[model samples]
Target: MTEPQGALLVGSVNYDDAEKTMRTASAVLGGRLRRIPDGEVGKRFHWIMFQPDVLGQAEGIERVGDEPRWRRDVDARPLRIADGVDAATLQLPPLGYASAAEDSYEIFRRLRDEGAIAEGIRFQVSLPSPVAVISSYFSSDDRAAIDPIYTAAMRRELDRILAAIPHDDLAIQWDVASELGIIERASGYGRTMESWWPGDPFDGLVERLAALVDAVPAGVEVGVHLCYGDAGEKHFIEPKDTATLVRFANAVITASARELTWLHLPVPIDRDDPAYFAPLTDLTETAELYLGLVHREDGVEGARRRIAAASAVVTRFGVATECGIGRAPAGTTEGILATHAEVASAW
Candidate 1:
C-alpha cells in the first residue's frame, strides 16, 4: 500500500500539560512527526489575545470603548484603542514573546535530552499572522493602523525564538486562517475580516504573508498552515475546492526570497472527491505538502480515501489533522495520533 511520505502535527495536541503532549505524541508518531508543539496547552487556544494584551497596556495606548465582544464568541471581549493613535508615532512594548518562547524551549529541551523525542525533530512554534489577531480584536477602522505595529511586535517574538533556540531544532509555522476569509470574501461565521489593502484582496494577502515568510532567517525551518477557521469543530466557511489555496500558495512561493520548508492545507472531512485536490497540479514548490486529511470521526479509513484522491493529482504529500486538535475532546488525542500513524509511513 502507498503511504504518505511524512506526517505533521498542526501545532496543538489537546493536552492540559506540555510534557504529556510532547511525550505522548513522540511515542505514538515516532519519527513520522518532524516537529511537535506544546498542544497550545494552558491558556492559549481561546486566549491568543494574551499577546496583544501586552500591547494594550503600552504608554500611548488606551482602551477606547468597553472591550467589544466578537460575534458569537461569548468569552471573547478584546481591547480596542480608546482614541486614534498615530501608527507612525506609536512605540509599542515587547509583546511577551521572548518570555513565552524561553519557557516552552525549556520543556522542549528536557524531552529531547531525556530521549523521549528522537534527535533531529524540531520544536515547532505556531504563531497567528498579525492580521488574524488584528481582525479578531480591532474594529474595522483600527485594523490597518494597528497592523504594522503588531507585525513588528510579533517579529520581536520570532527574534527571541531565533536567539534562544537552536536554529536546526526550530520550526516556525504561521497560522493563516483569517486570510482565507478575506480571499474567499466570505463573512466567516459571525465575524467580518475587513480587508485593509486597496488592490486585489488576494494580492494583498499574498504580499502580507510573503513578507512574513521572508522574515525568518535562512537556517531555521519555516512553513505556512493555510486554514479555514476551526471553531465549534467546523470550518468558518467550507472551501469549495483547492483553487484558492493553490493561488495563495503559488503567489507566496514566487514572492518569498527564502525557501518554505513545508505547506499545510486543511481538508474538510467530507471532501473525498478528486476535484478538491485538482488545483494542486499547479503547485511547483519543493516544500513538503501535508494535507489535513486525518479526521477524528473517520480515522484511518477516511484518511485513506482523502489521501487516495489527493494522490491522483499530487504524487507527493503527507498527513495531518485539518486544524490543531487542541479543541477536540481530551480523550480523543491519542486515537487521532494513532490514526496518522496507521495511515502514513513516517518520515
Candidate 2:
C-alpha cells in the first residue's frame, strides 16, 4: 500500500511556548499537519479540567477541597457535595473559553502572517469531554446530577471559542478519555468507571459526544480524539483489541449531524497484530482516520511497522503518537517530531 498520507499533532506538543510549537512544527511537518495546538502550557496536562477550578473561583460556585477529594491527587472542585441539595437550581459561571481562544488567536494570526505557519491549516483547540471532567472530580451521586450542568457550561465555553475565532481557521477537537474508561469498565487511580446510566453505557457516551460535535458551527472543522488515558504516558487499561474503539467511533459518526473532520484512536506500542486492527474494517466514517501508532522508543522504524500492520485492515490513514507528548521527558521533542516527518509523507 502507499505510505500514510499525513501526520497529526494530537495536542500538547512538548515545547517551551506556543511560538516555538507553531514555528518548529510548521518548519518540520509543514503542510502535513492540518491543525496545530497552542502547546497547552501553564496548565501542563490538565487540559479543560482547569476550567472548573477557574469557575470555582468565579462568583457562583464555592471551592470546597481542603483535602483532595476521594483521597486522590487532582485539582478539581465539585459544585455539589450533599445528597439532598438541588442540582437544577445551580448554574456555573461561564468558563472563559473565548478569552483563552482569542488570546491564542492573536499568536496564530501573527505567525500565519509572518509565514511561521502555512496558510490553510486551522488552529486546533482540544477540549476535554464533559464526562471526563465530571467523573474525575465529582462523586458518583453528584456525577449524574452535575453532568447536564457541566455539559451546558462546557458548551458555553465552545460558544465563546466559536464566536471569537474565525470559523474557517478553527477546528474543535473533543478529547474523549474517561468515556473509554466507562466503555472498558476499567478501574484505576483507586476508582472504577462503573456505568451509572440505566441503559447501555455506549448509548449514553454516543449521545453526549454527538451533542458535543453538533454544538460546533457548521463552517468549522470538528473531530473526536478517542483516547483511553494519558497519565504517565500509559493507558488506564490496555485495550484488548480495537473492537471497543471501532464501535465507539462508528456510533458517534452515525449519530452526529455535522461532518466529522477526523477521528483519532491510540495504538499501543506492542499491539501491531492484524487482530488489533481487524475491527477497523467496520469503521465507515468519511472522516480522516489517524492511527496514534508513533512511538519515540523505536522512532521511525517502529512507526513504520505499526503503520504496515494497520494498512492491512484499512486502505488509507494518517499517523500520530499514542497520545500527546507534552508529558514526555524533556529534551525528547525533536526526536519525536522527526519521527513523524520520517514515518509519513506530507499531505
Candidate 3:
C-alpha cells in the first residue's frame, strides 16, 4: 500500500488572494474599499516596538534614537502577515469580520466548483496563527491587552469560516511558527526551561493553539504547521528541536481536526540526518502527518531519494514542500509543489 492520491500536498497559500480577490466578489464585497485609502496600510512604525533584555533586540520591540521598530498600524487589519514575493501571509481581520469569513469560504468553494484545483486533491486551507497576528501589529509593550482582542477577533472569524465550509472537502492548517521547536533559543529569548522568551506568559502558547483547533467545528480537518523562524529563504538563523513540540503533538490528537501537518527541513542538523521521523512517534495516533520531504533546493533525483528515505520512517504519512513557497522564487515554488505531487503519485 501507498499513500493516498486525490490527496493534496498543499502548503500555505497566502491570504492575499482571499482579500484582493474579494474586490471582485459580488457576494463578499461590501462597503467601498476605496473609502479606506491604500496608503493607510503603507505606513511604517518609527520606533522599535518591543525589546527585552534576553533577545537583546527585544524581539522587535527595541528602537534606535528615532526609528520605529515595525511599520504596523495598531488598528489596520491585514488579511495576511505580509505579502512576500511568494505568498500573501494573512491575518484575522482587525475589525471583526462579521461576514468576511463566510465570504472567504465562498471564494474557496467557487475555486473548487470551477475545478481550478487538481482533481481529487485535498485542501489544507491556511489561516494565520492568532499569536503571530497579535505580535506582528500590536506592540510588545501591550501584548497582554492585545492578545485578548486578537483572540476574540480570530474566534469570530474562524467560527464563521469553519461553519461555512464542508469539513470533509476542506482541511485547516493554522500557520504558526512562534514557538517552533528550539528556534526560540537562537534569539536569547529564554535562558532556561523554567522561563520562556519575553516572559513565561507565552508558555502556554501551544495549549492555547490546541484549544483553537479543538474549537473548530467537528467537520473540517485541522492541521498544525509548526516551523522555526520563517523570515526569508536565507534567514539569519540556525535549526534546533524542542520537547515542547512533542508535547503539543500529543495534545493535538484531542482536537477535532483530522490531520496535523509538520514542517521538517530536508537538511541536516549538526551533520545528524533526519533519517527517522522520531517526532511522529510522539504524536497522537489519530492524525496523519504530511512529511516535508522535498527541498526548495532539490532536483528530481534528490526528490526520489528523499521520498524513499522519509517513507522509510513514516507509516501514515503524506508529502509536501518543506515549508511555504513564500519568498521562494515562483519557479522554485512551482517545482517544490509539483515535485511533491509527482513523487507522491508514484507511490
Candidate 4:
C-alpha cells in the first residue's frame, strides 16, 4: 500500500512544557505536520480534569468533596451549583484555554522566527466541547442550567484565542469525547454518559458541535477530533467498528455551515481487519481524513497493518495516535513520534 503523506498530533504530549513539545515535534516530524499544538501542558495535561478546579472557584459553584478524585494522578472532582445560587448569574472566571494558547503562541512564534520550526505550520489550539466539561464535572440536574452559561464562557475563551493569534497561522480543534459516550450510552470512568436534553440526544450533540465548528471564522482552519474516552490509555468501550463514527462525521458535515479542514477518527490497535474499516466507505465528508492508528506498543509495523486496512476503503488520509499522549508512560513519546514518521511520508 502507498504510505500516507502527513501526520497529526491530537493535542496533548507528555512533555514538560509547550516549548519542548513544539521543538521536539519539529525536529522529529518536521514537514509531516501541518499544525502544532502546545502539548496541553501544565494543569491542562489530563484533558478536562483541571476544569473542576477552575469551575470550583466560581462564586456559585462548589466541589462535591474536600479531597480531589484520583484519576491517574490527576486531581479531578465533580462540581455543583451552590445552594440557592442562580447558575445563570454566577460568572465563571477565565477558563484558561485562551490564556494558555496565547502564552504558547509566543513560544511558537519565537521558535519559528529562529528557524527552529518551519514557516508554513499553523499553531493548533484544542478546546473541549462544552458538553465534555459540563457532563464530566456537573450533575445531570445541573447540566441544562449550566450548559448555556459554560458554552458562552467557552465562546469567550475562543474569541480571546482568535483575537490574540493570527488567523492565517491558527487552527482550532474541538475535542469531542463525551458526545461519543452519550451516543454509545456507555459509562466512562464509572460515570454514565447521558444527555439531559430532551428529544434525540444524537441530534442535540451534532447541533452543539456543528455550532462550535462554525464559530471559527473563514480564514482559520477548524477540525473535529472524534474520540472514545482515553482514560488510563484505553477506550471507555472499544467500538465494534467505525459505523458510529462515520455516521457522526456525516451528520456534522451536513450540519455545519463551514467546510471542515479535517476529521480524525480513532482505530483500535487490534483492528487491522477490512471489516473494521468498511464503514469508512460511507463517510461522505470531503475533508482531510486522519486515522488515529499509530500505537507506541506495536510501533511502525502495527501502524502499517491498520494503514493497509484503512487503505482498502479510504484512498487518502493522515496518521495520528488514538488520542493525546499526555497519559502515556514517561519514556514513550519519542518512540511514538518516530512510529508516525516511519509509517507516513513527511509532507
Clashes of each: 3, 0, 23, 0
lDDT of 4 by residue, 71-173 (tens): 6565688899989988879899999999999999999999999999999999999999999999888886899999999999999999999999999999999
Where does the lowest 10-residue lDDT sum fall in candidate 3?
A: 32-41
Q: Relative to the true structure, how large is the alpha-carbon lDDT of every model?
A: 0.83, 0.81, 0.43, 0.93
| Candidate 4 lDDT score relative to the true structure | 0.93
**What tens digits encode model 1's per-residue C-alpha lDDT throughout 1-347?**
35798899998778878889889999999978889887777557553645455566676665545765443233355555556557667777876656666787789899999999988889898888888888776776677787887888889888888999989888999999989988877776466655886878788888999998998899899999999988778887899999998888989989999999999999999999899999889985656999999999999899999988988888788899999998888699999999999888867
lDDT measured at residue 83 in model 4 versus the true structure, 0 to 100: 90
**Better candidate by lDDT, 1 or 4:** 4
Most accurate candidate by TM-score: 4
| Every model's TM-score | 0.93, 0.92, 0.63, 0.98
Better of 3 and 4 by TM-score: 4
Give lDDT: candidate 1, residue 180: 93
Each prediction's RMSD over C-alphas, in Å, is 2.5, 2.6, 10.8, 1.1
Candidate 4 similarity to native, TM-score: 0.98
Displacement of residue 80 (Cα, Å) in model 4 is 0.4
Worst ten in a row by lDDT for model 1: 68-77
lDDT of 2 by residue, 17-95 (tens): 7888878888888878999888766554545556556656544455556754431233655554444558776767766
